[model samples]
Target: MMWPSQNARRMWATVATFAAFLGGFLAYLNVEPVAVLFQGQHLQNLFRDVFPPRLAVLWERSGLWWSVVETLAMAFAGTTLGLAFALPAGLAGAANTTPHGGLRAAVRFQLSLERALSSFFILMVLLIAFGLGPFAATVTLALGTLGGFGKLFAESLERVEAAPAEALAALGASRSQQICFAVLPQAAPALITGSLYAFDINLRAAIALGIFGAGGLGAELLLAYNTLRYHDVLALALVSLVLVTAVERVSDFLRQRI
Candidate 1:
């Protein structure tokens, strides 16, 4: 019988090491997946209570539709605000478009720090200052959008064809003129696509923020959950799912056209 080759031996050893570590973690955590799923009445009760969702709540609850509108408004306003700031930040952050190396580094670092902080955490802090509702949530979403889109916009700008900018530079065009004509034109499509994607993400974030008293469908869901109105909670969940799916579909269509 042929012995295993060196590469094959190493591959097997790697797999064995991963398996051992996984097993160790499972044991240490005292996890019993099989028992948890099959032995618990909790799952059965949840299914029983949440099934046959109360879709009628859509009409019965007068403010439900308005809350949905509020969520959409928050996302739109936040994305617009973020995009306004992010465009300048992105220009400064990009290697080719930046005025100076130090500025680029500083902008990149600030964007990274903003991205590292959770949007929900930011919302909580803002709630203390702004005192609840959509204003705080809007600002939180705007900051998140700023951090994410700033980096995306910078990368997009950097990826633009260098030839156009080089040609402009050879023609004795100023730095700002070269960027405005050569760089931005090429990056426009990407920027538009990224903005749409950012709005999609912000919409979901707005809904989640509402659960913490930001005021939207999530708030209604939380209220229902608190009162043990599982049926209404299920109904609200379906509404949220539909809203997200619809926005995603619209975003996809727009991206395809772009």
Candidate 2:
């Protein structure tokens, strides 16, 4: 239909432009010959593949149970190691908690230095020193957590209510004593929750790093995919989704309770 009115002509032009843009997208820009992507086949097996999915094949090759355990173990262990360093580092890096400004600055600087270094590079160096396995993954998780969690801890320290801490210090309480009573007690809930979140992140990174023989479900998953075992891929996918969801829910529940 021809639109004689000026407004109608403009509307039709807009529609044309939008249609052209959409069509361009559907007709993808092929950088290579068409045959290269699809192995020069027209893919006529569609109807057969469209039939009911085969769960038996998925079960036979997926290795669902073992991979889930391995992935959870990687996440749990990495997070625990990271939190172990974060607690002490956070305590040491706080200005109010340290007796001397110099000590606080020194520790804070170290935390920054750790954050600046790349975890992948650390894994590489450690792999040479310790060889590939959870040991390398653990070191990477620890150093990475030290920087990230230390910063969070230090910030939390700064944000804690100061009046009680001030009173304790005025009462001739030592720096550590004031921190234990006034600072840590007030901030413990937040600190604990933050560490859990950090652990979750470290767990994901540990899985990814495990690809280079660091030993975890991710390492196994990669092997499955490289071998073209789609069943195992499906299995890894399902298990990973479940574990990640469980961790996230638990972490969220704890954080909300805090």
Candidate 3:
């Protein structure tokens, strides 16, 4: 009737969790394992068609180079615009930094609303108002980034050491003055890091926005896919991969410096 030791309970819990996962995985796997070997024929055919990616498509296709440039521009502008809004919203949303409870609540609610809508959905709505193009994609990415960045920046603000701000307050500094002198200096690093991260995410979202007529590499890629141009798809995919990787490396380097 004695209770099990902590180690024994932990071990039993791990075993039970593993058993449940295995059972669910087996139940969900409707296809026979042997069928996987035969499935390679279709995979091989796909690889054969997709191999030797048509790098020439980047040049041979009219406006493709411009389209890539447009996509990068959209991502950059969107992140910049989103950060502009998020900076103020984040300041207002932070419990310590906000001027009042009502303002904080209102800002938090607005951020929640913005974060709730995905960029793809936002693009759909903007398309009706602005028509199809990179403009819609830029706006979509901006809104999505705003919501997420606002919340992140607010949290960063709230986590900054209160002592400096309190000391500033005791020295007769106004809230805005205190924030400028004390809070902002501490939070600036996080704000920059978050903005860069959002830019990376927006770049990918801008591509997806192309599927819905936002006119970036995504739209071009979708066209290639719809036409069953496997080589083109593979080529476009490689470009996207290289672009994302390069951005990620640069962002990582900057973040480390922060």
Name the candidate that leads on lDDT: 1
Error of 3 at 73 (Å): 0.8
Candidate 3 local lDDT, 49-159, one digit each (tens) = 999799899889998878888888989999998889999999999999898999999999999999897767778889889986677788888888889999999999999
In model 2, what is the error at residue 119, expressed in angstroms?
2.4
Least well predicted 10-residue stretch by lDDT in candidate 3: 31-40
- The best-first sequence of candidates by TM-score reads 1, 3, 2
Candidate 1 lDDT by residue in tens digits, 1-258 = 545797789899999999899888988999876788899987989899999899999999899999999999999999999999999999999999999999999999999989999777898899999986789988988999899999999999999999999999999999999999999999999999999999999999888988877888788889999999899999999999999999999999989988
Cα deviation at 228, candidate 2, in Å, is 2.8
Model 2 alpha-carbon drift over 4 Å, by segment? 1-64
* lDDT (Cα atoms) of all candidates against the true structure: 0.92, 0.74, 0.87
Candidate 1, residue 69: lDDT: 95
Higher-TM-score candidate among 2 and 3? 3
Model 1 / residue 11 / CA error / Å: 6.7
- lDDT digits (tens) for residues 1-258 of candidate 2: 655697788998999999888767756874344565477443544434323333454457556456556656766776777778777777778776766788778888998988898777888898899976677777777888888888898889888999998899899998788888999998888788887798678767766776666667677667877886655555565655666777888888988887
Top-scoring candidate (TM-score): 1
**Candidate 3 has which clashing residue pairs, if any?**
none
